[model samples]
Target: MSDFLQQVVIGVQLGSIYALIALGYTMVYGVLRLINFAHGDVFMVGAFVGFYAARALKLEEQPTLAGALITLLPVLLLAMVACAVLGLVIERLAYRPLRRAPRLTALITAIGVSLFLENAGQLLFGADPKFFPSVTPQGAGATLNLGGATISKDQLVLVVAAALLMAVLWYIVQRTRIGRAMRAVSHDADAAALMGINTDTVIAFTFGLGAALAGAGGMLFAALTYAKILPLMGIAIGLKAFVAAVVGGIGSIPGAMLGGLLMGLSESFVRGSGFSRWTEAVAFVLLIGVLLLRPAGLLGRFAPEKV
Candidate 1:
């Protein structure tokens, strides 16, 4: 029972990470119906940005609580801003011209962008993995007991942060003018444009907003146990997040979050069962199962077009 509880806690932590990235995937797809495969690369860039931000701020390798927090907030904001710019650039140069082109063309361009970012990242950041700076102060290995289970301070912080970010995103989508514009564009781009909403600008903003979230995900992911950050780190993580979005219903924000948590639980359960080798494959298997059971995902609703 204790083991089960522990796994559940870990699952939530992983879910938080996946949910953050999946939100980006769902947002971009909702607006453009484009996968933006390069999104994962933007996440990689975010991690790198966080690293440089830390170094630039001269953060100590081992920091006090106050110092760690002072460094954390600025680095996170910096990473988000950097990735937002990168996202805008990708939209303007690579995707904007092809917006009216065939979906196939746009799809291929997205893949091309993904490849370019990966290779370019390797060239710019080098191929070797770098240790992410710890955001927790030294001697901060605190744990909280839940039933018979223990949850680390890091896990608690991540879960809270993810929840806060998700809440803010929800508010933006539900209450803000830009979010209303986004929805209007998503429902009918032509109609929205005719109604005087700047469809093009909205689409670009959607991309930037999603990319910024992905950046936050990158920073949090790296901070987890001080994970290694590599140029290709986003590939697997991005894939999982994509799966989460699909499982939750690609265009539904809430669906993306639910799907992430579900996948995280599944992976954790599989790992606990001693089939750790199947951890990665388990997510895809769950995706296949979900598709077979509900093509539209858990919360997804779809109506077939009349022929």
Candidate 2:
């Protein structure tokens, strides 16, 4: 029971990170039906931003709750803003022009953008790895233990923060006017525009939102386990999150969150049971299984096509 609880807690913590990153995948797919392969690199950029900020501010050498928060606050804001702008630019410069082209064309463009960003990032941030300062205060790792299961402060923070962010996203998507426009655009961009909705603006905003979320996830991930920010960091994580989005039902906001959590937990269990090598394989196997069993995904419903 203790071991089970431990794995569950760890799984939730990691899953929360995946959930945040998965939002980027689902949001872009929902709005534009385009997979922003570059999103993972946007996450990588955020990590580097946080890394430099921490170093410049001497955060690691002088650790305090207030100090860490203050140092991070500005860095996170800047990273989000930067990534959002990048997302908008990518949409406008690379994707919009190809909107009328074949779906394969758009996909190829996304892959190109992904490659460009990775090489550009390597040049800008250097091919060498940058170290991230420890944001989790000392002893925080031993702060909580229940029934022989320890819940580090980092895990608690990740879970609670992710839950809060998801709640806000749910409210925005389900209740807000902008969200309604987003849904309309997602359903049919042409019809939405004919009805006076600015589909272009909606799509841009969707990319911005997704990029910002990915940026935050990147920062959190760096704080948790990663210290080095590489241009290619997003590739593996982004791919996994994409799988999670598909597993939960692509284009379903809630489904992305659920799928991310499930993927993380599944991977965690596999690792805890002495099958660490299968972690990556498990995600793909699950994705293929889900696709085979339910082509539409767990939360996705089939929609009738217009004649």
Candidate 3:
């Protein structure tokens, strides 16, 4: 029972990471109907940016909490900004031209962008993984006992931070004027433009928003795992986040979050059952299962075509 509880805690923490990444996927898809496969790489880039900034600033060597935090905030902000710019560039350079092209063409372009980013990261950051500076101070570990289960401070922090980010995204998407414009464009781009909305700006805003979320997720992931940044790190996580978006209901904001959390927990449960080897195949299996069960996903609603 204790083991089960511990796994659940871990699952929620990991799921938060997935939720963050999946939000980016779902947001881009909702607006453009494009997968934005390069999004995973955006997360990768964020990790690298944070990693390098910390290394350059010697964040790990900071002698005081205030010093470390002073450096961490700026680095995180810079990483997020860089990722947003990268997202905009990709949209303009690779996807914008293919907007009127066939879906297959756009997909091919996305794959190309993904490949380009991976190789480019390797060239720039090198093939070796580089560690990120610890944002959580040393010896900061705390635990809460829950029915014989222990939840660590790190897990708690991760879960809360992710929830806050998701809340902010939800507010922006559901409450803001720009969000309304986004929805208008999503529903009918031409109609939205006819109403005097700048569709290009809306599209760019969507990409920037998604990129920012991915950047935050990348930072969270690195902090939780204490893992170094790597070029190919985005592929697997990206695939999983994509699966989460599909499972919860693609294009639905709440659905994406739910899908991500559920997928993470499901993976944990599956691994706990002694099927650890099946972890890699879980996303594909879930995707196939969900498609078979509900083609539109759990919350996805199809729009009626105009005759």
Candidate 4:
């Protein structure tokens, strides 16, 4: 039981990161009905942003709780903002002109953009993996015991931060005017435009918002789970998160969260059982199983065309 609990704890921690990234995927899919396959590259950019931000602030030198907070908050915000702009640029330059083109054209463009970002990252940051600087305070990373499970400080912080971000996102979607506009546009872009909502602006905002979340996820993943950052690292993680979004039902907010948690738990359990090599394979298997059982996804409902 204790062993199982430990895996659960680890699963939840991993799930938080996956959930954060998956939200971006579902949101973009909801608004645009297009998968921003380049999103993973945006996440990679966020990690780099966080890396430089932390280094510039000298967080590595001033390792204290207060200092860590000072460094962490600013780094996170900057990374989000940077990625948000990148998202806008991607939409405007790579995707906008092609909106009227064939769906295959846009999909190809997305792949092109993704490749550009990855190659650019490699050119700028090099192909060698870089070690992320530690922001933890002096002797601060101890594990805490909870219900017969050990929770690391990193895991606890990541989980809490993810929860907070998700809460803020929920509020935005549920209560804000822009949120309503987003929903309206997602439902029917032409109708939303007729209703005086700027579909373009709403779509752009959705991209920015999703990108920001992905940025934060990138930073968290680097700081907590994986410190090694390479230009292509996002590929694997992004694929998994994409699978999570699909599993939860693409375009369904709650489904994305549920799918992320399930994916993480299954992977963690598999790893715990010493099947670490098959970890990546599990996501695809689950996706196939879900598709066979419920083609729409675990939470997705099929909507017939009104035409």
Q: Provide TM-scores for the models.
A: 0.95, 0.94, 0.93, 0.96
Give the number of colliding residue pairs in candidate 4.
0
lDDT of each: 0.87, 0.82, 0.83, 0.87
Clashing pairs in 3: none
Query: 209 in model 4: Cα distance from truth in Å?
Result: 0.4
Candidate 3 residue spans exceeding 4 A from truth: 61-71, 139-141, 304-307
For model 3, residues 128-235, the per-residue Cα lDDT tens digits are 877776655556334678988887655776788789888988888789999999888888888999999998899999999899889878876776568768999999
Q: What clash pairs does model 4 have?
A: none
Tens-digit lDDT string for candidate 2 (61-171): 325555655566777777778778888898899998998898889999999999998999888888887777776576643358889888776677668767887887778
Q: How close is candidate 1 to the true structure, as a TM-score?
A: 0.95
Residue-level lDDT tens digits of model 4 in 238-298: 8888999999999888888999898899999999999999998887899999999988889
Ranking by TM-score: 4, 1, 2, 3
As a TM-score, model 4 comes out at: 0.96
Better of 2 and 4 by TM-score: 4
Is 3 or 4 the stronger prediction by TM-score? 4
lDDT of 1: 0.87
